[model samples]
Target: MVFYCQRHCYETKYTTKVVSCKPAKIDVVVDGKKKKTACYEVTFEDTILFPEGGGQPDDRGTAGGVEVVRVVRRGGEAVHYLAGGLEEGATVTQEVDWTRRHDHMQQHSAQHLVTAVADNLYGFATTSWYLGEAVCHIELHTGQVTEEEMAKIEDTANQKIRESTPVTIAEYQASDPRLIEIRTRGLPEDVVGAVRVVSIEGVDANMCCGTHVDSMADLQAVKLLHTEKGKAGKTLLFFVAGSRLLSYLGECVSRERGLNTLLHSCPADHTRLVEKNQKELKGAQKSLREALKDLAVCEAKTFLGVEPRPPAFFHHRHDGDNDYLSAIINEINDESVLKVLTAGEDKGPGILVVHGPPALVAQIGPRVCEILEGRGGGKTRFSGKVTRLGKRKEAEKYVLGALNGSVKET
Candidate 1:
């Protein structure tokens, strides 16, 4: 079988025949280790699967019932990767993912129209473009574009789509005079031979190797969603075209409905309602925190006034902080007193030990860590968190023992 070097084959169809297939090894890194796996890298005489290049992803599909996991162009040849090896010179049918292909076509076509409009309107050349699954973006040569300017550009691009302008694909030799007449962002130095040009009827003539739709109408719409600054003062305009625009609109509507339900307010007044609710929540939280601080102080005073004083007491605070714990310790006012406080719900118990004698706390803090089977460090006034919730009692016992001189060091 003879293999023809028809690089533009993917521009027309979605299926073609394979010309050569061979066993190959691909290194895949799993858990930080590279493993070489047996696979087949098939080359087609005329391929409909576009390789990953030109800021567009490769086409996903299958060949001969085996999944084409990846497609790469190596020196003018499109190599299709498959886990299941195919026979060399076998005639296998390649099926491309239609949804993804169509989506790419819309996005790539939208990019060209948008780029052309921006250039024609403001002389802002497109520096780069990306066709993402959810959104597409093109970086312009300007620092930033105003909201009004972006709206104008978007309107112009969509107008072209609404006009149903024909998107023509043509190939030209490197030395062709017509090539110089076309608008291009300049081809890479390595690009040689026939250059494929995608032109949008009187709008744009760009030297692009990426696949595009047959007409601007197929794009359906081009909505410029947002713009931000990129590297070297470039302004990046994010947009959605075709079905993706519909998907984005659906999501926005769903979110608005949810917000209305939760806030019991209309979409127009959502911001005002949310801010009011937040203020109320903040005030309530402040009051609750003050009550907690008062309760902690009262509890500390009660512990201090006990008829028969113990060496230390373990207290569980629903929610405690450094200030709350310190206030409690201050009210007790006993040099020999030791207070071990814990505050947690589902999280593993955390320890905050405060003692009257700084030296004693410095010594006993590390021992508490050992007893709890956790890790911590402290200085003069020792305070550290405990991780093991189950061992909370054991940790307290060890700390109390050390304070009362009941536990001896080994």
Candidate 2:
């Protein structure tokens, strides 16, 4: 059966009688968390909200003043999932989200145009297509699409839009011989009744069920953003049309303006300036690493100069990374003294490393990790992540006690 949505694509509101209302639960994400929400699966005698099918998402709208979260076709019926239940046989006003509907119409119509143009120009048949939230793409049965070809396809698509080609839809029976002429991936296994064919005036015709604009002019323009390699030697052509294209252009302009302000350069010079800054950053990082290594050596020497060397040594640095801790451990190179080194913020997450006699390192490593709320294991050298760097003093005390106890046993 042809749905009310398919018949009247431009209608935003309609009054229909409720056929059925059944309690149902659906998963919905609220504030970043997914949870089951109670709703009613209500079927109307007729609906302006399109059910999801043919690679197009369902229309969002309101039924009986309640939000319709989702809609799907079950057999020959359009089921509207409403946030609230409506009385059976009651007449209710359904309002479609016009902005969303128009966006989908523009995109869906643009896909038909792009697919036709590609096939006609380069003999690339559409294998599949995706209608994403921000952008849409069609997978062409080809290995690649060159830059020159892409430009030609995009130019031709916009030219068609300028000409305002008419888009027409017609229905035919399953036994009709005309079905062989229409382009189609295949009809659904459960498809019943007539086949819907959407045709572009003198351009192309295909079997489709998605709502679309009446004319190519409604698309305003089409932009072939880029191409990516797909499975089985297919090429994915990404594009945006109408409002989505305008939104993408707006984002590009905003980013360009921000870059100009930060780099104090024009759009043409921004790339060069960014590259120079990255090179300088790499140099600065190299110098810092060398300086940190030298400082580690000096710290090790200072500890070695002590008249009476301590049994246990603890060191903490607020800024260095795990590499810096490893540098300090390598310079000391003492197997007798228990060395505990940490690097990061005082009370935040950090790295922990312990080096000493094999027996002591194994025994104290895990204990120290527990004290600092970290995890690591080793025989003579242990390294792991720690979350409680502020407990460094307590961990040091535990290590010292273990050493003193060992000495007493000896």
Candidate 3:
């Protein structure tokens, strides 16, 4: 006998099961016309794998040294597909990856816990359960569960875990319909086969087919990721359990530390610091604009007594003194003489150099743009922003002196 249902995975379908697993291996040829490996038909003794039943995913792992590639249900028997087929008389020790099995156990039993908790607390049954990647989910049978209520349920479930309630597995055979309450959605109706039930003491009691641990503590914790409304008043609760809970908490702490370091304060300061930076940035922009205005005044003064050469150009290069440079160009906004200004911290700020009309500023503008990573266009007339002014103070003094040409260099 083999416990099998028609499915590609562990998803249980609501139909009469014909036969169950029997501990015997049989050899079968596969890919008759196509190039396929031989397969062994065998009864899996362990209950770790959830054969595709009731929308549950099929169990995955290896069997007989070959990967248990697929657990297919063909004619009410789970056809365990192996990478390499075994002979009819071959003896192999089969083992399932405990990590995967343990996780599946958590999800399946947690599904029961959730269903039980909902029914006890809110008179709701669980219609379906899905243990997906990164999260496990269950759809509540009926009624609405608010987000807060879900949180409360999650807390209760974790409380149960902390309580370390024992999980008991029992097999029963009864003709009474009340016994059917313990059967998960997809057990055979006609046959009086023994039904398996997993009970978590007072916390939960329900019929289940998947493997389970002996205690709720084995789950470690059930962390609710979120929940949302499902079809027909059903609500889906997405969650993580066991080691996944630890990993999720670790990530959360790491993120908190990262954010704290970035903000240079406690995690609470992140939001505050963002607001502070925004206000400071606006003030800094206003100050920069005002500084630009002062520099423009200085430039206008510098252009006061300039030599009236026909094609004289003024180029100002300074270290972080763009205000004066731009001011000079703006004052001499004449198309006859091109102007260029460049300044920045990368250029050491405040270093000023200027030449004009003798084709100096015009020829040097492009080279300065390349050197200082600046950009501007002009035809021997005034055009350029402070591309790089590394020496702001010295350049400002020299340009101011040269602009008036009155203050002799001391």
Candidate 4:
């Protein structure tokens, strides 16, 4: 939207009503759209009322007697979209959401403290940053650090937060020491402007553009959430400050209570309780499968007498996969006269094999598999799968045919 600073700049318009939430929204044309600009944006020309351009989120507030829902940076210009639409050329006083702003200040300032302090303690520089709602992240200058090192970093950072050191903002010329220049990415070639250095007392001094408080002391507590390796061996750090710290602690406590009740144990024993449950589950699965195997062998004895001959059968189902199928095939090769049971699926499972002589098994597997689209292979001695599908009963018949060919008992 065009910024009209003086009467001469554009036709002047005024709000006859006192501006507040309830006031009738005047039709304000933003860019070309008819919408209200927030209270904070009412005074500035193209200049932004909120923070933008960095990874940090825009400052939120009210402008032009309307709620400033969001402050945004599109391309390069900063813009504020308001709740109540503004008139095409109307004028209104601006307002801001102050409490939220203070919270942001704490977060930004805490970032300064924790990052700077960690660097000093662990000798890992913060290579990059992204300021988000719940957490602000910084990429360490080095590629990676051990978990123990990260713990040390965290401990030192928190200690600094508790120390509440003063954060100083100072303007430095290009001639400033290389130490100060190291913080910002190298200056643009065309730009020869003064850079502002924000110093966190003895903790850190770096060039930064986003707003920060006067001291780390303002941050009630800086809490490190986690640290993990990133691209190029960089370490990413997540942290919370002030009110967010309190919120996190509260959530942790609630989770502990629920876990304690569910496990019927003290909080300290949660790890042991979870491990016990996992072991018990494993034991149960093993015992049930052993019983099923014994039953299957007994049932196979009855089927031994009534099959066709020389059947090299191929049947597959999903539940029994490649690993078990391979094992079954190995067993058949070792025994020559045998039955194969497999699970047929995409990966091939629930396949059945009944051994028999050549003539009876001829073309039976192919014809049966035509219904389920199952495939099998065998030499004079054995056949195995390339592909297979459903049609389990027909698959069984094919196996019986293949097996009948070989065994005289059947």
The candidate that achieves the highest lDDT relative to the unseen native structure: 2
Cα-lDDT of candidate 1: 0.77
Runs of candidate 1 with Cα error greater than 4 angstroms are 1-17, 23-38, 188-192, 321-323, 326-337, 347-377, 381-390, 404-410
- Encode model 4's per-residue lDDT on 1-410: one tens digit a residue: 21221111111222232222232334566788988533433323432244453344555555555666665544333455566655544555554455565666677777777677766676777676777866777888777667787677777767776777777766667676764445655543433345556778776777655566775667777777777778987888888887777877898999999999999999999999999999998998777566544444443443444466333324344555444444444433434344445555654433534333434434443444454554665533233443444445665665565446545555
Q: Evaluate model 1: give its TM-score.
A: 0.84
State each model's CA lDDT, in order: 0.77, 0.92, 0.60, 0.57
Compute the lDDT of residue 342 as modeled in candidate 4.
52
TM-score of each prediction = 0.84, 0.95, 0.54, 0.59
Q: Please report how far candidate 2 places residue 342 from its true position, in Å.
A: 1.7
The best candidate in terms of TM-score: 2
The residue-by-residue lDDT of candidate 2 on 80-112, one tens digit each, is 899999999999999999999999999999999
TM-score quality measure for candidate 4:
0.59
Model 3: runs farther than 4 Å from truth?
Answer: 1-50, 54-56, 73-76, 174-178, 181-192, 271-410
Which portions of model 2 miss their true places by more than 4 Å? 31-33
Which structure is stronger by lDDT: 1 or 2?
2
Ranking by TM-score: 2, 1, 4, 3
